[model samples]
Target: MNRLTLCAAALAATALGAPALARAEDGRWQIKLLGSGVLPDGRIDGVKTDLIGLPAGSRTRADDNVVPTMAIEFYATPNLSIETICCLTQHKVDGAGALAGARIVDHVLILPATLTLKYHVDAGPIRPYVGLGPSLFVIMGEKPGATAKALGASRVTMSNELGLVLQGGVDIPVGDGGLGINFDAKKYFVDTIARFTTTAGVKALETRHKLDPWVISGGVYFSF
Candidate 1:
């Protein structure tokens, strides 16, 4: 079985043994599918426009791209949990005004996985929690067009990313052991080490890009 399934089984076994686990479901595992949105930023390094008499516009856009995410969380204690999310992301790059036709779409798979420790506060039927953790992220994509002259026919590439994460959430219990609803928000301090190449004998293009985005998600949680 997968790690999530294993976690769930462990939680179930623990719940059967301890009254705290049975009542609070302290070690339960949670899974969620989150609809997410990505904010993209751009930067061009090591290339000077005005100094080299070149008119290169290296500006980032504030376009929000929607993506889908899958997550698995495990509660070590009733008040503490750790989670990971995977987002399938795609970005469109427009080559300024004159070179608008030279646009490209980059398909990125982003995994913002975190290992957080949370502290929950009980408030009647509502539970609120806050967490801080370390995160690792990976970003990868394919070349916009394989036969494009500029890209030189590079098909696919990948990046290694690392970051920190901060998160908070609230849970609204429906009925006794029936179902629960959850709402959470997270922010990732992500940085990517990107390396790519093209078929035009270009070996490698390496750069480190940084970005931070806030994510909001809601889902249902069922406890037995």
Candidate 2:
């Protein structure tokens, strides 16, 4: 099965069984396993330099990815916590419009690392939260795609960037136990500059990109 289907099934099953293992929440730490959707809006912001002539109406888009993630949270008080997640997400950028059906970059692996300070409140049995944080999109690896190679691009590199993230979510306690279902969403504001080096060892092209991704997740959390 695909990753999304697998994750959804796991989430549903665990949530359904949460009540049986539920206990009172008296611990300061919580751990979670979540299925996440990495939806990115990767579009060209500007072409700073281009040795190869790009067609008019040239545009780019990034395909989305789904992956499993683990989160750790430490609650210092009843209403405050520090949270972070561990995961790696990968995506590809493809040409659009005039360069339709062409791949520009591939295997762009990223570690979207974040550290947030969260505020929580209770609405009956539901714990709702909001968070703000700084984020770093670490470019673990990337390379030129087939189309880029055809255009004489021999190397590709993207800059790692710092950005801000806003988060919101809710947790539903199924019983007295700390077992619960969690749903969360985070919005990121980030930008990166891409450089393409040709076989002649010259920087042939450079462009700026905006990759503001919306990270949506659903899963189960254990408080202890």
Candidate 3:
């Protein structure tokens, strides 16, 4: 009777261990679809120009945007993963300080491509993770608004940027399968040059714009 009891215990352990092992090894790829709200929390400085119509010592502010974001994650191990994130967003630039209430820059599209190495802590149904990586900030589609054009500014141009990205987030598993909810915040540190053009004869106004933005996102994740 004791031998039969031991045999039953061993069979139960094997049955549970087999399923757990299979679950751990099967789902290595994950895709996340997120909605992100971008907030620019940096300053624009070093405004210099030869034009006379614009205000002296003027500064700028970047507007916010809510956009769709996506990421693909590959788990190299149970605790370590690599993820790539991308979102294309448009931000408006308005004058601050002396030039307040004036829209000098319009419809600037920012495309951020980031790659991160993440370390996750497994704590039952909720997993917390932190990541650090590099990002490429591609600035394009800049258009000068009416106020800028009237001030002899014919074009708005910004240089592309490369910077460091830091992120932290949590994942809450829904069921036994590989579906979960993810919430994260990311910070980008990038500095770029902005130049404003005038008529063909005048030298463009150049300034250093610090575009450090904080992005907060939340959405669904699926692993397969």
TM-score, one value per model: 0.67, 0.86, 0.83
Model 1, 12-111: lDDT tens per residue? 4433433332334457766665566666553333331122122345332223576555555667676666555555455644443333444433455454
| Residue range 1-224, candidate 2, lDDT tens digits | 54345334433433343333323253277888899999998899999999999999999988999889877776767787777764678899999999899999987987777777799996778999999988888885789999999999999999999999999999887788889999999999999999999888899889999999999999999988
Question: Given candidate 1, what's the lDDT at residue 167?
Answer: 84
* RMSD score of candidate 2 (Å): 7.3
User: In TM-score terms, which candidate is top?
Assistant: 2
Candidate 1 residues lying further than 4 Å off, grouped into runs, are 1-26, 42-57, 95-105, 145-148, 151-158, 195-198, 203-207
Window of ten residues with lowest summed lDDT in model 2: 15-24
Instruction: Locate the minimum summed-lDDT window of 10 residues in model 1.
Output: 45-54
lDDT of 3 at 29: 74
Of 2 and 3, the candidate ahead on TM-score is 2
Q: Model 1 misses residue 199 by how many Å?
A: 2.9
lDDT of candidates 1 onward, in order: 0.56, 0.83, 0.78
RMSD of each: 6.5, 7.3, 14.4
Ranking by lDDT: 2, 3, 1
